[model samples]
Target chain A: MLDYSALRTVAAVIQTGSFEKAAGLLNVTPSAVSQRVKLIEERLGIVLIVRGSPCTATETGEWLCRHLENVGMLEEELLKQLPTLAAPDEARQRVTLHIATNADSLATWFLTAVANFTKQSHHLVNVAIDDEDHTAEWLQRGRVLAAVTSLEKPIQGCRHLSLGALRYRATASPDFMARHFPDGVTADALVSAPSLLFNQKDRLQARWIRQIIGRELAGPVHWLPSTQSFVDASLAGMGWGMNPELLVGEHLKAGRLVELRTQTPLDIPLYWQMNRLAADRLADLTREVVQTARLLLRHEGR
Target chain B: MLDYSALRTVAAVIQTGSFEKAAGLLNVTPSAVSQRVKLIEERLGIVLIVRGSPCTATETGEWLCRHLENVGMLEEELLKQLPTLAAPDEARQRVTLHIATNADSLATWFLTAVANFTKQSHHLVNVAIDDEDHTAEWLQRGRVLAAVTSLEKPIQGCRHLSLGALRYRATASPDFMARHFPDGVTADALVSAPSLLFNQKDRLQARWIRQIIGRELAGPVHWLPSTQSFVDASLAGMGWGMNPELLVGEHLKAGRLVELRTQTPLDIPLYWQMNRLAADRLADLTREVVQTARLLLRHEGR
Candidate 1:
């Protein structure tokens, strides 16, 4: 069996981002924290935490953190079954579940799912946002127990469930379309029109552009990273972007924004991936994600 | 003179994240793009692009990007004065200016400032998010040309303008107040109540708690990263948090939310810091940010 106390020390160091802070939290000396870290590294024969001002866990350390997460789940279940075991100061028993998700989903329907779960459960959460295509990497690295991802196939030692596709409409304010596509959205016109890109990782615009225009063009772009601000920028005639239908449905109906193309929407299929060990234990979260996504995301690929 | 062709090549690689994509954008062969990158790195004797599937810039590379930004500003100025010099396909000439700001500022009043700026200016922006106390580091590292920071002192070689304090109220939903602080808030009651945190970098709750009750206690925390979600979680009775006054004013007025303590609020002073070279050229942005922040943020640090 692993030393649970030392493992928690490792978790504390990563959480607080320093040996001194971790030691303070654990009510131990900094040297004691360092000694435990060094001993664990020797036992595992791998460096766990990278020594820095704000310390970070290495891949091996992340695996250990995942182990502790599983242990936390077991403890939570055990205490549920035997109420007498819980300390009177049981508020401290609440363990934070780290989950990864894309920003667009968070803005649209993801929070509703989690909010309902947190309402009933003793669980709290740490939500880390990355691009849809990349959230799986967070799960693979053991940085997060589960993720909303683009990968339909489960990563090794993980369970996969389809969460349906998030549909996007290539939209712009009417003024912008009239000014830039007066002669229609031809390849030449697209080459000169401005686009709104979320970041380098965001490829919804690039994918939609290729799907519509059938080729790649280096268009000028405004990189605005917020989902709400992305819609706001498009509405303000800054650039054209692939706005999630949920975010712009009202604007589109009111004719404040117009789609670049009629009857063609990009559907990005999403999946929920979770560590196999934690799947049954975190069943509530999985259910909330799947049920919410089913109700909200586009089920038909078209 | 510095090799601008090589510099643009560097920018393309970082923006596109690979040599092949950079080559495609520049209408050059992959080998030619590679050659230009190598020549520039050798001439400067520093690694500009960190070779990866998605190439990233080193600190030195960021400084070079900042240089390119200044040049783009100058060229934009020149083209405006001499309209005939601008090519018909000048949409490609739109340059992305990078700025860093705190999440609260973005959610509250910063976007309004930039929104108005974009309505008139030809410039597009890439906004980076960080904790207010840490945003100045983005300017210091040359990753961003300007930032909304909590630092009253300007970073070296940058202009600083005070942009007032953002006031925060320590608040909870009526349900939460009734459940957790039925007998009125005290240190003992707070020790058992769950609290919402923006992230580890967010110290507002901890600071507020220290001020109100006058001691530190290890309370359970829910780490919700979104500015909007933070307020939503509070409304849902998930936990108490220090929410910005701008975001919670309506809730307070409607009595949906109540302060954890009345009459005491934490005020975070903000400032705008920009690269000296870009300061004069990007005057409109500085003006918009300062003006908007002045109108929105709390003038007196109460």
Candidate 2:
């Protein structure tokens, strides 16, 4: 049988990113936390942590953390059934849900789902940001219990739900359009103009270009990792970028921003994938996400 | 002498995250690109790229990238002097500069600095996000040519200049304040009210708490990582958070949000640190950053 107390100790270390802080949280000595983790690693014959200035979970550690999350769900349900065993401090009773999503979604509509879920449930959330195409790797590695990703296929131990497509438009300020695309939005002109990229992992602009222009063309690119700043950079005429339709809608309507071409919008399908062990317990969150997606995302024939 | 072609190959691989993609960018075959990288690695006796689904820069890889950034600056100057030797495509002339900054800085004023800089210069930017207190580590680890950081002391080989302080207020929607702090703001109420945290690295809220309340008290926290979403979550009555005064000023004045207390504010001093090697060539960007900071950031007695 797994020792849950020591497992909780391991989770705390990963959560706080230091044995000292975890010790403070659990009211134990730092050495005791370290010793407990070392003992668990020895018993399992696997290294669980990459100890550093900020400790991170290894592959085995992520699996253990996933197991702990399901166990936490079970315990929280029991606490609801028998309220006598709960801690007086609401903080102690609440559990933080670890999830992952793309920055654009988080900037647009993912928060609506998460905020609504938090308001109704006694749970907090820790959202790790990654590119849409890469968040599935987080779920596959067991780093997050659930994720909003671009992958259609489900992982081995997870349930998948279609969340509809996130539509993107190659948007630029009117001034940028006049400066860079005076000859119209063409593959030749695009080779010179700068484009806003989320990061190296972001292929939205490349994918959108290939879809519209029918080929891969390289251009000067500015890397603005923050989603809001990416839009702001586009508005300021620093670069043309693929902005989510949801975020650029008002600006588009107001003519503060304009699309590069009339019919060049790219739609990337998003899906919600979660570990099957926690699927039933996280139904409320899943419902909120699906409902929010239905209301905000682009749907077929809509 | 370092093989400039091979170094460029390493940079291309890191920028594109795959040998095939990098090969396409350089108009070369994938195996040739791979062999060149392998030869350079063998000669250097250090691993540069961590080969993965999406490749990453090893510590030594970061150092090489930094050196390349300095060289890029010199070559851009040479291109200005002699335009006859430049590539026909403007994309080949422009270089991407990697810099690190905190998310709040990026959301508020950092983009303004970068935008103004890019408008005049042909160079592009790539900004990496980390906590302000930790961004200097990026500079130290040779991961970036420059960074915006909170550390006052000078880094070993970098030029450090104060950009001024970014002021933060404990803010929330009126509805949140009423529901969470019914009996006035006290330690007891704070211990029960949920707080907003950016992530585990964010010690701002806790430090703010220590400054105002004079003790360590625990509370429930919702982890919202997006800077814009963090503000929106505050507006939605999710929790009280440390919001940048720049972002919340209009919201505060318009009655969309309010401060938790009358006199509680946290001012984090920010600094711009860059490699001295690139300082002379990047004087234009450094000037724009400092000038923008002077205009937007709060200074002593201001």
Candidate 3:
């Protein structure tokens, strides 16, 4: 069995990007930190860290880090089940749980779920902001324990929980619509109008165009990568864009943004993809996420 | 010669992530957009775009986009040389230039350079914010035409120019330092104290620990990903951190932040890396970036 304390030291080093920082985190001497790492390396017969300006884990080191993180979560679950086993003076360990999520969900309803979880548990949340289409990459790389993704299929060694659908509306400032498409959103008018994009990877605009206009779209495109900035740009009449209903609902209702008429709103289904660990904390987190998502998002079947 | 118009159509589609959007951009019907794409595919006898929710360019498509962008730059240069060749009714096309840069640079002195360039040239600047260590990935993927990186070595098909050094100081709020280390920074005190980090990838804290304490550091770490937030967290007494001289210079002088005495400040050398394109616009941009960097950053080899 691996030494949990040594594994923790190794993880701290990688996370903090230095032996000294890891030593400081573990409340151990620099020599102690070094000794622990050396002991592990000697046992494994392989180099673990590539020391430089900031230290990075080798391939084997990455695997070890992942294992340590998983084991830490399991240990926390064990502590919850058998409170008698916990030493009186031993403080409850705060497991660092890394999660990958999209900007829209983060901006809209995800934070509430996170806030609820943190209030109930002693855990550090490390969130990696990414597009829903791409969050799986973090899980695949073992960079995150869980992710909010658009993909329904589970990654190997992971399970999927369907959250719900996030509805989006193609919207623009009233002044923008008047200036760009004075008559109506026809083929010719669209050619001259500028549109807002979240990023190059964002397909919502294109998908919406196909669904609404039933044609290829052409226009000047402004790429605003940040969610808040994208919304602000849309409000400032930079261009029309697809805005999540939760984010822009108030703006749409208050006449700050005008929704372009379409046959149906674009609904993107989101899923919680997590490692298949039977940890209570993970289960509790999943429950909170599902409950919060259901309260905020449209039912998937609908 | 390849049809430049069709090539532009293809690029717009890829950028906008939809055929309909590309058609809208080209001021053509959806069928026209489809025909242009089909024509290009037939001419090349290879697929260019992989149709999906958001269309992505195939290997051939990426090459074509690069060619078209280069050709567009050359055309602009030609127009500049021979004003008589310019059509009276044809508006000047705004070239899009993608640049990858570190977050610190983007948050500090880079925007001034961009603003200056935009004032003089009709070009749309797309800035991709990444760590200095990782900016080359964007260049390798052809996602960016230029990059601001710390790597001294040039990537294949690219050239590198030394920008300057960005000095960093180990600092914390006065209250934080007193609370954490009542006495001077000893190894035992440092281990128990909390530190603020920019992100998991950030190594400035670790580097500072090694330089200042000459040993491994141990501490509770708070990861704040945003540059502004990282500074705010430090100011809020969350933890000590390595603050950029440019960003925290005023704070240090104003007594808001106390500098931890070390042997010397950490100086990180930066470089401007770009494709070896002979476009005048590219030349102009490089000149502006180099000039601006020299003004803000410490001149290297001085």
Top candidate by lDDT:
2
Quality of candidate 2 docking, DockQ: 0.59
Candidates ranked by DockQ, best first?
2, 1, 3
The CAPRI classification for model 1 reads as acceptable
DockQ comparisons of all candidates to the true complex: 0.43, 0.59, 0.20
lDDT string for model 1 (A1-302, tens) is 89877888898888777788788667789999999999988987899999874688898887898788767878877777888884554325568799999988888888888877877777878898899989999999888889999988779999999888998999999999998999888888887788888888887877887898886666777777778778888887888999999999999999999999876789999999998988987899888888899899998743
Q: After superposition, how far is residue B259 of candidate 1 from its true place, in Å?
A: 3.2
Model 3: per-residue Cα lDDT over A248-290, one tens digit each: 8899889999987643589999999987753345877787899
Q: Which whole-number lDDT from 0 to 100 does residue A288 have in model 1?
A: 87
Candidate 2 residue pairs in clash (backbone atoms < 3 Å): none
What TM-score is obtained for chain B in each of the predicted models? 0.87, 0.90, 0.82
Span of 10 residues, lowest total lDDT, candidate 2 chain B? B86-95
Per-residue accuracy of model 3 over B1-302 as CA lDDT, tens digit each: 88877888888778877787676666778789889998998998999999885788998998888777667777777887898895543334556677888877765676667646644666666777788888987887787889999888988888888999888888878987888778867777776666766676776776777777786554656554556545655676666778778888899889998876643578889999898764345887888899999999987466
Off by over 4 Å in 1: A1-3, A13-66, A78-92, B18-20, B29-55, B58-63, B74-92
lDDT of 3: 0.76
Candidate 1 vs candidate 3: the DockQ winner is 1
- Candidate 1, after superposition: displacement of residue B63 in Å? 4.3
